[model samples]
Each structure stands twice: as structure tokens, then as C-alpha cells.
Target: MVWIIGFLVVALFVYFAMLGWRGFGLIATGEVAGIGLGVGVILLPIIGVWLVYSTLRAGIEHQQLARAIKDDGRELDISHLPIRPSGRLERDAADELFAQVKAEWEADPEDWRNTYRIARAYDYAGDRTRAREMMKRAVGQYHHVQGR
Candidate 1:
């Protein structure tokens, strides 16, 4: 999985480099197209920086959450989670497992940790939309908790 992630990062970098190269080529023409391409080239790095920042911030936040959970005497044991080799969960089993967590989440909808836990379940179940929605909620609640 680490190798896959590394490969993907390299691939994305190469892809973005190609795009920037093309943009630079267009900009060299010194035409109206140059202005547009120049804008694209500028925006690409800004977006890339934002992406990296967001990913790193999420990692930090997740680590914080794990620490908080541990301090609260809760153990997050995800080893039993039925993830397949395809990076998706076995849907039926995931659904069954998530049902319990869903109940927990429903009981305390305002708890960011619960929200994040449910989001993980949604991700394991391959429900990206719900996972993203839940994660947004979780992040919002976390920010609220932090008085941010």
C-alpha cells in the first residue's frame, strides 16, 4: 500500500509537471493563450500546495483524535474491519459492523470522534459520498471543540 501511494504521488507529480510544461509552452507564444496558460500555471502550484497542506493537516488532526480517544479509555481496534484487496470493504459485513457504530453515532451526533468513526465505516463500506459528508461534519465539530 505504501508503494502504491508512492507510485501514485510520483504519477501525479509527473502529470502536473507535464501540464505545467504545456502551460509554459503556450505562455512562450506571448498571445492571449499565453495569459490563460500563465494563469493556469500559477493556479496549479497553489492548488497543489493547498492539497498537500490539507492532507498533512488531516493527518495531524487524525492523530490528535486518536490520542484523545486513547486518553478517554477507548480503544480503536480496526483490525477486524473487513477490507478487501481492492481497497474496499466487504459490503455486507461492513454494513453489519457499521450498523453498531451508526447507532453509536446517532446517539451522540455532536461528538466529532463519533462522527469521524462513522466516516471511517462509510469509507470502509466504499460509500465515498457519505464518508466525505461525515468527515466534513467531523472536521467542523473538531474545529468547534478547538474553539477555532
Candidate 2:
């Protein structure tokens, strides 16, 4: 899986480089419209690289936090939760679980562990937007606590 993802990322980078080369070719034309289009095209690769780098960094950080939490035996356990046919947690059970996790987070908002749990709860409850928000918070808190 890692190899596959790495290969895909490399391919994406190559594609972005090609686009950047084309953008430079356009800029070399010295026409106003070509220069404008060239600038826009060049921005695409720059933005793409930044997005990929940031996403991979966050994923690595999240994995590190998960490993630390597991080592400390602080990982959230959802084994008792009811599951639906599609392999997701039943909606009601997920909501109840989220309520419990949210209360824990509220009680000690400074704790990265609690924040991580709440993020997972939000994910399980099918609230992707909130889950991503909480996960980003958890990542920042974890980094701060680790002095990283």
C-alpha cells in the first residue's frame, strides 16, 4: 500500500513538473495573454506541491500520535459499539459514543488525548467537517505538548 501510494505521488509530481515546464514555455512567448496564463499555470504546480507536502506531514503526525496513544493504552475502544450492515457503527450508537467523547473533551480541553478521541468520535458519527477540524486541533495540541 505504501509503495502504491508513493508511486502515485511520484507520478503526480512528474505531471506537475510537466505542467510547470509548459507554463514556462508560455511565459517565454512574451505575449500578455501568454504571460498571464503562464503565471496561472505555474501556480497550479506550486499549490499542488504545498498541498501534498502538508497533507503527508499531517498524516505522519497523526500516525505518530496514534502510536503514542496506543503505547500509553489510551486509544479509544469501539469494540462494544453496534455496527450496521455496511460495517459502520450504527447511527444511534455512534451519536452516544460521540456524546461521551465530547464530554470528556470538554472536561479537559487541553489534553491532546481527549482531543484525539473527540476527533475520532466526530469521524465515527459521520460529521467529516467537524472531525477534520478536531483532528487538526488534536495534531496541533499533540505537537505543542511534545515541544515539536
lDDT of 2: 0.92
Q: For residues 1-148, what per-residue lDDT tens digits would candidate 2 score against the true structure? A: 8899799899999999999999999999999999999999999999999999999898898898899889989888899989999999999999999999889999999999999999999999999999889889999998898898
C-alpha RMSD values across all candidates: 4.2, 1.0
The candidate scoring highest on TM-score is 2
lDDT of 1 at 100: 78
Clashes of 1: 0
Instruction: Tell me the lDDT of model 1 at 58.
Output: 75
In order of appearance, the predictions have TM-scores of 0.67, 0.95
TM-score of 1: 0.67
